[model samples]
Target: MSHQRARGQPALVYRTKTIIDARGHQVAIVDTENPTPVTAVFVPQRSSRAEVAGQQDIDVTRMIVSSDTPEVTSWSRVSWDGSMWDVVVPPAYHHGTRHTRHYSIDIRRRPS
Candidate 1:
């Protein structure tokens, strides 16, 4: 009998690294070459739209539902629909009563 937990890999998540420049200033560089590929989906949060409704704030929020890559945090970023988004909060692991699990990460649109 096979007893392997099924995991899916569907998308790529880009991450940035902080490095000190010659002036000793920290610089964040995005690693687009070696992205972390995982099974994740960016779900648009209703609160995000409602919050920005009739407001000057252009920020759009989303919940990244992933079955893997629990390490993804506020330091991570994702490119979707030709725009980059920044993670706004840490991952929230949800454990269902039936033993189901997933990671919920809140992300906001990166300002230009």
Candidate 2:
């Protein structure tokens, strides 16, 4: 059996994608063809609410650091532990040594 890493957990991220539909209408949809699999390290964050320019108040719940940087955008959502969390912003990539190469992602719990 493979041993699980204490700092890394399996996670899924749905990157933002656009495609043309039947009527030649372009539509933005979550790329489900292949959910990006990533090894994420969960970061504890205090729940906070903030309002964007015209959007409603958003409660940011948690964050995750991953070594992989897919096409995830601010509109992307992360599915973890059977729950979906909205990406708070564009994935932030930190440039550093090989061991520190990772992306910092903030996410909010999706409202029911």
Candidate 3:
């Protein structure tokens, strides 16, 4: 991607915590610590005619950011527009001559 196209706005990264209640049920909670600022491009998923006809309305967003960002795993969550998206897969790294240039992560909106 071109540098101009690659430049993206700042976004927030969140980490989740799982707590077992007194009843032994697992409860997941989002940490309230200040979010990490990362430059990322959020691209909404495009639906084809067949996908639309099949009644698939899954809204997936692809977030592209620098590969050097630390602790960005599949368990990481992205916050945008007051909603959280789950990291759907491992980060895909793009390598240059000596180091990675960027990484892309696909995120799907968490169901309500």
Candidate 4:
């Protein structure tokens, strides 16, 4: 199925990286500069309980983005509905003859 025909919604992708601060401390920085506006569909996979002391509920969702989306990596995250989801692994890229057909990434709700 073509991506254009799919039910796509607007999503923001955030790229994060580790950097050394002036105090010689390592810190992670998140950049939203020139954020790529991609159309994606959020499909819920399953919910599981966290193993931590709080036993928080973790929601696993699959975000299917357009093939044209760029700069997405495991270090990237998606923002939707005032919630931030972390990309758990490398995205699965589906390529067509000329270009990428679609991309799928598994994201999980950030543990509080």
Measured by lDDT, the strongest candidate is 4
* Each prediction's whole-model lDDT (CA): 0.61, 0.70, 0.72, 0.78
Native RMSD of candidate 4 (Å)? 3.3
lDDT (tens digit, per residue) of candidate 1 on 4-104:
12333245577777789999999877666767755555565634333554654346555545355635656788766666777777778786543356667
For all predictions, the C-alpha RMSD in Å is 5.6, 5.3, 4.4, 3.3
Give the per-residue lDDT digits (tens) of candidate 3, residues 51-79.
55545446788888776666566667888
lDDT of 3: 0.72
Q: Which number leads on TM-score?
A: 4
Quote the positional error of residue 27 for candidate 4 in Å. Answer: 7.1
> Each prediction's TM-score against the native?
0.59, 0.71, 0.65, 0.75
Of 1 and 2, the candidate ahead on lDDT is 2
Of the candidates numbered 1 and 2, which has the greater TM-score value?
2
Clashes of each: 0, 0, 0, 0
Model 1: lowest-lDDT 10 consecutive positions = 1-10
Q: Is candidate 3 or candidate 4 better by lDDT?
A: 4
Candidate 2 lDDT over residue span 18-92, tens digit each: 889999998877776678877677665656445566555455644546455577888688888678888877777
